[model samples]
Target chain A: MSNLFFVDKISTENIQSIENEEAHHAIKVLRLSVGELVYVSDGHGKWISGPISEISKKSLAIRIENTGETHAEKPELVVVQAFTKSDRNKEMLELVTVSGADRIIPWSSQRSISKWQSDSREKWMITVKEACKQSKRFRVPIVNNQMSTNEILNEVKTGFAIVFHESAKEKFSEISLPANLDRIYLIVGPEGGITEEELQLFSTINATVVRLGAPILRSAHAGFAAMSALQTKIGRW
Target chain B: MSNLFFVDKISTENIQSIENEEAHHAIKVLRLSVGELVYVSDGHGKWISGPISEISKKSLAIRIENTGETHAEKPELVVVQAFTKSDRNKEMLELVTVSGADRIIPWSSQRSISKWQSDSREKWMITVKEACKQSKRFRVPIVNNQMSTNEILNEVKTGFAIVFHESAKEKFSEISLPANLDRIYLIVGPEGGITEEELQLFSTINATVVRLGAPILRSAHAGFAAMSALQTKIGRW
Candidate 1:
């Protein structure tokens, strides 16, 4: 199937016009003509199927014939990633989006190299949105603003919580999968790794300390690794 | 601990001299003095601890005091990755090294983008060595020259062989851990993914087909995910 674009609105009855950037992309880049079928998702669970009705240099029109619900329901997996440098954080965000994480919480730990500003949060959201589109995800993963360790612990819902640290004794496969749980929270530390106080806080909250393997992966790699392993173990993969 | 370098040889009795690029780096960049201690690994599992004996612009010398073995006696995990474009292949190689794979083999698949040449093999080995140094690994992962998929499959030793494919019914965690097997062969396909015939061939040879998750990950990302999961499951993490 061809890719679907997220648009503001589509006229379901007769002819729908795509203007500005979308129109330019369809007419100039893709060179779509009349009667060409395409799909458009509004990024809100509604997907519209249509064919090109009119094509122009500045605008293109398509008639929406039918609509379908695009809902991908999986066990919610929240990735709590400690703030890394800009490039590493971007790669981590893309991985999390493609890995089907339900939510992403940027965390501020003692060894974090990058700090989030109020203005940059919206820009980061755009990156997540693009990743979601590329990965064919119907709904975008929620990117939350920076939060402290205590704030994350307090906000965690009733589910299986795991903190991946190198010092942990239990491997991820050894942990018992929790029954009757719809969410899983995974916490990954910064480059220098989680501090003693952070580990103690997670322990106090009864979070399982899970270790991946012998080699020490970077902070970004560890997040994806943990998510993949946990999802496979829970049969959600 | 400071970063360690891999050298060709270490003498037991007299002062060991570092020449060429390494000497320049030690003398000019780090500005290490005569009494400072430094570490060196021979890349053959020998780690040497010594103090600087002499320092100069062209050469620096170190007197070896003690030597020890730093090899991990755990199971060997080999990652066979299909060749992609240069940038993506480099990223995959770095991930394999960082993820603690013992060896990395570049194989030509039906949809491989880049063709491997004999002259470029040395350059690829350098990339693997650099990745090993950056990841703080004493033993550098071996980078084999490019070969065909059938050639690789034929060379697989007695171990738990698995291929990560999206069409696989069983999740990687479903495979039972083998007790006496010390080698695990992980085969990761290209961007277009493994062909149906390749999957059937692997099945005919008793190689287990394993799936990572529901979301479609890029080829490089899939290799890291599989390696991380298998490492954790086998108690090597």
Candidate 2:
């Protein structure tokens, strides 16, 4: 796939305009011009690929040839990641985004060592967007604000909920996911582990506790492993 | 589990010595002394949890009480990663080790961006060892010497192999693993992707070509996703 630029004009008459950073990169850095093919995305699954018809200082207009929309795949994967150290949390966010999670939730578990800043949600969204462009995904994942354990329990009780614990009796693959589940919620605890109260809360709410196997993973890496295993088991991968 | 220190002698009379950096940490940093409890591992899978019997400037000897060996898990996973840029190649090595691959092979593919130096194997092992300790895995993954594509094919002909390709028609979840399989090889290409020649080689060897779904992962991140998915499929997750 070519470097895709996001634009607002997807169904424009004959020409679509590319502006902002996308335009600057094409004209100044890549030196793209008329007659050169530039892939464009509306960031809502709509995509267009055609030759550039007009190039000015601010924008490059592309002549539309063909356009298509990519449907989101299933079963959808949502990762609820605990707040860890700053850099490690970012690493986990980037890793899961690249691994193709449908949505990401920043969770503040009892044992979490880090606290979310006032701008933490916005910063996390930026990280998700950067990962989306890097992985060339046309659709950006929905990034949620920092959530308390009670808040997450309130939301996930309606879906298939999984809490990854080292002491869980059943392995992750052994759990039988019930049907009518369009999405799976993967709960990753902090490095120190979820407190007894937190585990009790989820257990009381009927969330299945599972283990990812022998090795203990950091808070950030667990989401990648859980999402991968769940996606494969749900037959989407 | 207490903080585990590796010892060269696990089957000693009653005293097991924890020397070198492990000793320094026990005595100096952790301020551990005799009569204190400490976990010890031989790293060949033998582990003992007992009290510290002797403490010196360079070593902390432990008294063996409970002794047991950890059995290696089934369906051993192996990742053959194509060499990429230095930092990314190291990142891939660290990722797969933490994901529980039993062995790793550095592949010098036709499109490899980085050449494996003569001492690269030793450096790669260091990365693997670091990841092992970080993940708290008792079993250390075997780091193999760098191999050309031809060499990998020669060695992998006996095992079930799956080459991850974006153009593959079947998803990784679609393949049925044969029973009694001792090992599985996951071939991951460089960022530029597998050349036609390389894909043809594995295809000719009857390796199943599979996709990990829609998003394109970096060469460093693909192995973790592939290993996690395959381990789940084989009932080891």
Candidate 3:
């Protein structure tokens, strides 16, 4: 496969215009000239196959040849992670994107150290988009606004829900995954872990409490590990 | 659990002397004083419960109150990873230790960007030790000197072996683990992935070729996922 670049929008006609930023990247950073073959994804599941027609300092034009469908519309696995400190939260977002999580909900648990502000939601979206581009993912995962534990639990009632805790007895491997399961909601606590009331709420709601392992993994690492394992178990990965 | 530190050498007596770098860490970094409680490990499965008895600029003395029996011996899990660039290789080592692998062996594959040098072996050992400490592991995973792919295959004669490849037909979860299997060897290729010859060699030797999922993961991330799955499959975690 050749290098794929993501563009915000593109047309199917012979002459297609590239976004200003993408044009600068192709002409200045990648140094592509006229008639060079390149691929661009519109983040809407369409892969535009074309060649560079005009390379200007501000914008580049491409002649489209064919279009291909490159994505699926399946309901995605969303992780509702309790907010940690800045460093760990950033790492958690990176890991979740790389591990192919569909959405991330910054949650405020009883033990959360950091609180999410409405102003910072856009910044978090930018970070997640960058990670998606780096990982070559066609569809960027959604970043939801911060929610309280009760709000998240309410959302979990609509899908397959699982919570990761240290004291859980059921190994993840032994859990029976539903065959027609489409959307999965994973809840991870902060570094200090979930409070007893939170666990009780999950238990009362019949959420599957699973254990990854005995050696306690950091919050960021545990998110990735659990996502990878769940994907493998569900035959998605 | 409280913070635990590993010392290189410790006498089997009730009185223990901390010197050199550890002493500096206890005295300056953590700011522990006399009669304070601390946990120390010898990095050989032995953990000591002790309290500081004396303090000085260069030395801190501890009086051991109790010695617990060693935790269960680590199940042998060896990681054969192809050499990556410096920063990525370091992250790979950190994840390997955090995932509870017992040993790491660097491999030089056809697509490897980094070449192993004799002088860098010591630095790799230090990285592993630091990762072990940061992950709260009592024993540091052994870092073997660099070896060729052929050499590793020759040495791994009888134990269960698995290779992670994107095109493999079998999923890792489909493999039936041995009842008494104590050792497992996982081989992961570099970012460019393994060559056809290496795959052929593994196939000829009946090594299980497994795929993690449909989505392609970076090489460094593959080993950690495989180890996590294996640990769960064997009921070791």
Best by DockQ: 2
lDDT by residue (tens digit), candidate 3, B1-237: 455667876569888778888788888998988888876778776777678999988888888986764455434889988888777877778778888788888888889997788777898888877776776677677888888878878856567888999889888878786767667889999999888999999888889988876556677777888787777666555
> TM-scores of the first chain across all predictions?
0.85, 0.90, 0.88
What is residue A232's positional error in candidate 1, in angstroms?
2.3
Q: Once superposed on the true structure, which residue ranges of model 2 sit more than 4 Å away at CA?
A: A25-36, B25-38, B51-53
Better of 1 and 2 by lDDT: 2
Identify the candidate with maximal lDDT: 2
Q: Please provide, for model 2 over B1-237, each residue's C-alpha lDDT reduced to its tens digit, 9 standing for 90 to 100.
A: 457677666865777788898899888988986788776776667778789998878987788887777778667788998888788866787779878899998899988898888899999987877676666676778888889888999978879999999889899999998988888899999888999988999988999999997878888889999999987998878
- Which one wins on TM-score? 2
What C-alpha lDDT do the candidate models reach, one value each?
Answer: 0.77, 0.84, 0.78
Can you write out model 1's per-residue Cα lDDT over A1-237, one digit (the tens) per residue?
344566777556566667877678777887887888876666666667778888876987778886777575555789989988778877888877777788888888888887788866787788887776666666677888889877888866466788999889887778886676777899999988999998998888899998876556788777887877776676666
Q: In angstroms, how far off is B44's CA in candidate 2? A: 2.5
**Which residue pairs come into collision in candidate 3?**
A237-B213, A237-B214
Candidate 2 clash figure, as a count: 0
Per-residue alpha-carbon lDDT of model 1 for B121-203, expressed as tens digits? 78778877777666667777888878787887786646678899888888887888668778888999888888898887778
Q: Which of candidates 2 and 3 is the stronger one according to DockQ?
A: 2
For every model shown, the clashing-pair count is 2, 0, 2
Ranking by DockQ: 2, 1, 3
lDDT of 2 by residue, A1-237 (tens): 466788776865777888888899889998886898877887767888899999999888899887878778656778998888887867798888877788888899888888899999899887887777777777778889889998999988867899999989899899999876777899999888888889899998899999997878878889998988987998878
Better of 1 and 3 by lDDT: 3
